[model samples]
Target: MGKTIAIANQKGGVGKTTTAINLAASFAVLEYKTLLIDADPQANSTTGLGFDLRNIQQSIYDCMINEGQAADVVLGTEMEYLKLLPSHIDLVGAELELINHPNRENVLKKIIAPVKDQYDFIIVDCSPSLGLITVNALTAADSVIIPVQCEFFALEGLGKLLNTIKIVQSHLNTDLEIEGILMTMYDGRLRLSNQVVNEVRQHFEDMVFNVLIHRNTRLGEAPSFGKPAILYDPDSNGSVNYLNLAREILQKNDATKITNQEKILAASDEQRDT
Candidate 1:
């Protein structure tokens, strides 16, 4: 089965959606089946990939509410292995609608379970809130990846998010773990950027990846042009960084596979000896 990861953070302008779009595209380029699930009401990830939001008759909102099946709502893009679950304004009302439902936090998990094995990676771009919608996203994810911007208040909102994760692990989803913390909007020339990086590393240590996403115009411009940085400007620094992040993800997946294989072989040997 594929790994379902939520690229989430409660802070806006932290590159969560951008990371989701670009990373999904990058993974597709690497020959992996990838799905980008837009749970954000704004539908930025959907539009960024050139989808007309109004025309996407069904989206994640409908899937969660049982108005439609999850697989039926997946929209194809030009990329061979990349698909999108588009979002729309209807998503804005989901929090209020889902409040009274039984096992409310699990709605998304149930909706996505049937299709989990169809993709190599499922990336959910969560809304910038700790509300019910985001709770649903967190509840459904196997791992959470936080994108921290390299700014003065970089660590400010992290505590609340960490607390939420603690609650989810203790109550709702015990098996969910932090995938990694990504440092975004890095400005190599600024001393404050370095300071922010040092402070985050002090708290997260090796949990942060070495590849930092520098503040590049192409990253910001691509969305307006309705394309990923990779498709917008293949040689841009933003494109290069996201591609490296994709490589990091695959490397981790490969390591996990090797570890599992070793465990299986050892188990077989034990069975034969018995």
Candidate 2:
């Protein structure tokens, strides 16, 4: 089964979409079959991967609202192993359209079910809101990667987002957990940025990623050219940081798998002895 990670932050301008694009790209570059779902109506992830929204006939909106097959809408990106489930501007209205549906929260989960096992990782880029759309993303994800901007208001609204995650865990997806909290757009030259990073690390501790995505002009410029940082400029700071982030995620996942296997073997040994 594939691991589904929803990249979310209720606060706008927090580099949520940037992380979604680059992290997924990094996974693909590392030879992992990765799929990115542009759940946000803005479709930034789609465009960031060099896709034109106007050119796409079927999008994630169709898959969620019109019962369109996810496999049919999946588009190939520039990267060999990366794929995208493009989003449309029409997705803005899906929240109201599915408002009355009994299982609205699980709509995305159902939409992506048939194709979930085909990839090693599936990343969803959520809009900056705790609306029905974000709820759907949460319900469909096995884990969440929250990107927090390294600024003065970095901790603001974090409690509310965490509360929302708890609600989703309790009522929707019991297996969902916070994969990690990423510190993005950090500027070492700025005293406040350093303070914000320390504050966040102090609070989240092990939950915070070791890789700090420093504020770089190249990171901001890559998206406009419709390419991820890794593909746009592999030697840039933004590209290097994101690659480190990907490695950290892979190592952590490997450690988790080994730990789980050890537990299973220990149980089997006990059973045999008994």
Best by TM-score: 2
Clashing pairs in 1: none
| Model 2 C-alpha lDDT per residue in residues 1-274, reported as the tens digit of each score | 8899999999999999999999999778777889999999999999998888879999999998999999999999889889999998999999999999989999999988999889989999999999999999999999999999999789899999999999999999999999999999999999999999999999999999999999999899999999999989988999878877877898988833333433554477589899
Prediction RMSDs, each to the true structure: 8.1, 8.2
lDDT of 1: 0.88
Candidate 1 to truth, TM: 0.91
Candidate 1 lDDT over 86-189, as tens digits, reads 99998999888888998899998888899999998999999999999888888999999999999989987899999999999999999888989999999989
Show pairs that collide, candidate 2.
none
TM-score of each: 0.91, 0.92
After superposition on all CA atoms, how large is the RMSD of candidate 2?
8.2
Query: For every model in order, what is the number of clashing pairs?
Result: 0, 0
Sliding window of 10 residues with minimal summed lDDT for model 1:
255-264
Point to the candidate with the largest lDDT: 2
